[model samples]
Target: MRIPSTRTVPTRSRTAVVDSVWSDAKEFLTQFAQESRGATDTDRRLREVRSAIEATGTYRHTTEELTFGARLAWRNAERCIGRLYWNSMTVRDLRHLHTADDIAEQCVEHLRTATNGGRVRPLITVFAPDRPGRPTARLLNEQLVRYADDPRSRQRTHLAQGLGWTRGDKDFDVLPLLTRTGRDDTPRFHELPSDAVLQVPLTHPQYPAFASLGLRWYAVPAICDMALRVGGVTYPTAPFNGWYMGTEIGARNLADTQRYNLLPTVAQLLGLDTSSDRTLWKDRALVELNLAVLHSYQQAGVTITDHHTESARFLTHIEREEQHGRTVAADWSWIVPPISASATPVFHRYYDPPNPHPHTAFVHHASAADTH
Candidate 1:
């Protein structure tokens, strides 16, 4: 969630051994066993998983096991800054669904469920996983919903067009979902119902002219690029989401040169001197843009968090996890807010190394088109 920066994970190009699968399963199950206080038969479960992996080249996770693993994956995502509410995520077991039509519908359902009428909820929908020699489906879009005709979404936008999806004229147009059921299967485009997408039109709290820019963003940032790995099984189509952090929208998505690049426009509107970067015109505009994003989301009653608040919450999260004797891994460079680096509490502290932890999900690849 939080539409994290690029992260690379070991992709499952070929089947791994039983030992590899069991090792991850054991670590995950051991934690669950502790939570269960030995109520569940851990040893027996481990034996079954090992045997299943040996026989089928992959094992299955029960709904409970899957839910537990999904939660842990969110918890172990070191690049994410919004892990404070990781345990609140709901895991949808759509493993039985593999058809392009079925997976497409569930993805829409995921959007509706996560959107929650703008009170977005954290959720993940696990579709069919890659088998020994049979790979499952993958969503081509970086996110379930994104603006069309933007630099960030050009590749996917073109891909959708190639799939017979007509491009929209406006930059804020939502792209269709492209689902690939198998390696040989042609990707199908699925149009998202307009009701499922809740967008907040941006406006500055102070500047009336800012509203005319026609800037807005989708409410839910459901990321679909990351493959969900738990116990050696890889669910290539597991899409998960958390609410946005304000700076992610303002400082990165809107302000970054590669993204919407709205700073120059905001500066012009504010009548700031663009004659030189020495005037800090860009800095002033960046802050204003970030403010507008946070302000507009609040005005629209959508679920969003400001960087200052999220940073403090992340610190609180570290403290809470430490109390339970769990190591909360974090990448300091990724965790720190892009703006106001010195003001947040998270800026002063160090964290665990950004190593790949077992049972985690975030492996950003599509770069969140059109993100933030």
Candidate 2:
């Protein structure tokens, strides 16, 4: 899954509920109820959902349907390469929550449960959806734990300033949760407690001095802003996460030129000749950086997957899905590891095109902030 950038895109209109949504909802309810319970009361259940939607421009999903939908969304995530564990995900229904404080508290709870004492589990918290006249609260952070760079710092990223983050001694000072009360509401920032967050300071087994770099990351990668759509209803405040593949942190978050951009800094520390791109100094530093990320997370007793191991496991997942007679849809650009693409098993194959309508899906919701 693509991590949301801090930059806000311009808003258009609230997404219209899917066309033929009622029919689709009925089909899903009928099929799922029949398969799971051998029930043929789909016509009745379909009327139930239809009545609710026609009355309120929305419908409610039963606990069974909600759980199944959440899992299906993970299965349908086209950009994600970790669909192997989609069935094992834990879904928390927080559709009752609407206030900013309530939403913030549940978000904290999600982090605690997903962190799972460093044995990270795939989890999602589904918050209330935006109704015809009532817009649910929204979180502004791309991930639950992201840093704020000083506006004056040369390394500041595109969307750094004006989120009410204070400058610190280091570039990576953790930012508070920024949320909006309603669709038209101004954002409010809340400071998260230290205990609620579990962070692993980066250190290298080979380069003992790497600890001095003051790099650290949160245990959970909880994404709090994406919309979770299931059976024609859209929950705008749903937050979810799976455990990290180390390259996501080392290669993209920390090393991307648009992000922390730490390759030059690390290369300087490693005494690499940065005078020429011909020397492959960046490539060398990247390897060491990833090494530090893996080593640090492991020593800290956190769950993290290495690219080589994860690549092989992805293939195993593909085989298993095929055996079950399910198509394995994938995006090749995302399936291959950021580093050493040719070395992995996922590099040589073409994936089936994504199915347009999966039982569940993560849909991007244009933020109210973007409208102004």
Candidate 3:
């Protein structure tokens, strides 16, 4: 099927109103400068910057502040059980980039770097934000690599199949990055080169026949649609990712019925009786599927965390944060693993009420596929 064209968004100025800019700048600088050495001098500089913002209706973050804020956002992520490594996140400042083409190239580069030849790394790349004359830039792909599901569409132009993978191929397809430079700009789609994406074909250690299933998945899950909010400034096109926890793929991505929904197929292949829930065929297939994911990633020399170990590590994270006198806010639904929820310790504990972290946070955007 040929890819559908998107409508151009009308351009509009986004300069912060004078009063709001003044308030946000003053609030942010006060908190930022208070934490740095030589507070008196930094406070004076803050006043000067605030005055400039009042006059110009905008301000730029210093490299130090940008780095701090980006890391803080990760630290503030309530749904992430992997925030134990939040401090280790690397920030790439690309705020100067204003074009979608440049952003797309950098995003591809991000995938390559984070892929790390199978050992993934946590990282984020900041892009330009909406300003007076510039409309916000955006990436249309949910992740750098995601499968497309529409089968009946007529438009088939690009890639080997002329569209995404056909349903008969188990629908393992790669989506091109679609983006627009600004609200007024025309959208364009760019296909990712094969060398840049690292995928692991799944197989079981005990069930050698599992290899015939032809199941595979990308190594890194780089989330690309969220806006990064730092010190009251919003960057609509910032893309970020942490290394995967196994269940994110095994239990959720591959097992979810709306997604690949391979449990019934696997059960049939394994010769298990699936006439009723009492047979526990679904449960048996789920265990094998997760095992295949973990084993395959290990065989491929990739980084992945088993849900059990990660759940324990999350407790350690909570303790460390508590020792530092910081409350660890978390959503119980997200903190618990998708499968074997009652089997993990995180399932039994009560956590601090979820609250916004002052320094950093990863916030969601509307579904990218819905935006067009």
Top-TM-score structure, candidate number: 1
Q: Write the per-residue lDDT of candidate 3 for residues 194-267, one digit (tens) a residue.
A: 88889999999999899998888889889886778776677788888888888888887888887778899889
- Tell me the TM-score of each prediction against the true structure: 0.91, 0.88, 0.86
Candidate 3 positional error at 101, Å: 0.8
Candidate 3 wrong stretches, greater than 4 Å: 1-40, 150-170, 356-359, 367-369
After TM-score superposition, the amount by which residue 197's alpha carbon in candidate 3 deviates from its true location, in angstroms, is 0.3
lDDT of 2 at 234: 78
Model 3: number of clashes?
8
lDDT of each: 0.83, 0.79, 0.78
Q: Write the per-residue lDDT of candidate 2 for residues 1-372, one digit (tens) a residue.
A: 998799653333112443356756876686567546544577787777878766665678877788888888888787888888988999998888877899888888888899999999899998887765667788876677676662323222223335454544466676677778665676776777778789999999888788888888878888765788887777888889999999999998889887788999999889999999999999999999999999989999999999999899889988997897877888899999999899999998899988777656887767722323
lDDT of 1 by residue, 1-372 (tens): 588869664445224455677677777777777864433788898788878877766788888888877888888888889999988999999998877788889999999999998899999999988665556667888789888866888877777788788766677889998877555677778999999999999999899999999999889999888888876677778899999999989999888999988899999999999999899999999999999999999999999999899999998899999999988888888899999998999999889886655554556534222222
User: Residue 204's C-alpha lDDT in candidate 1?
Assistant: 93
Query: Evaluated with lDDT, which candidate comes out highest?
Result: 1
For model 1, the local distance difference test gives 0.83
- As for candidate 3, its clashing pairs are 1-155, 1-156, 2-155, 2-156, 9-183, 72-360, 73-360, 73-361
Residue 247's lDDT in candidate 3? 89
Residue 185 local lDDT, model 2: 70
Evaluate residue 188 in candidate 3 and report its C-alpha lDDT on the 0 to 100 scale.
Answer: 72
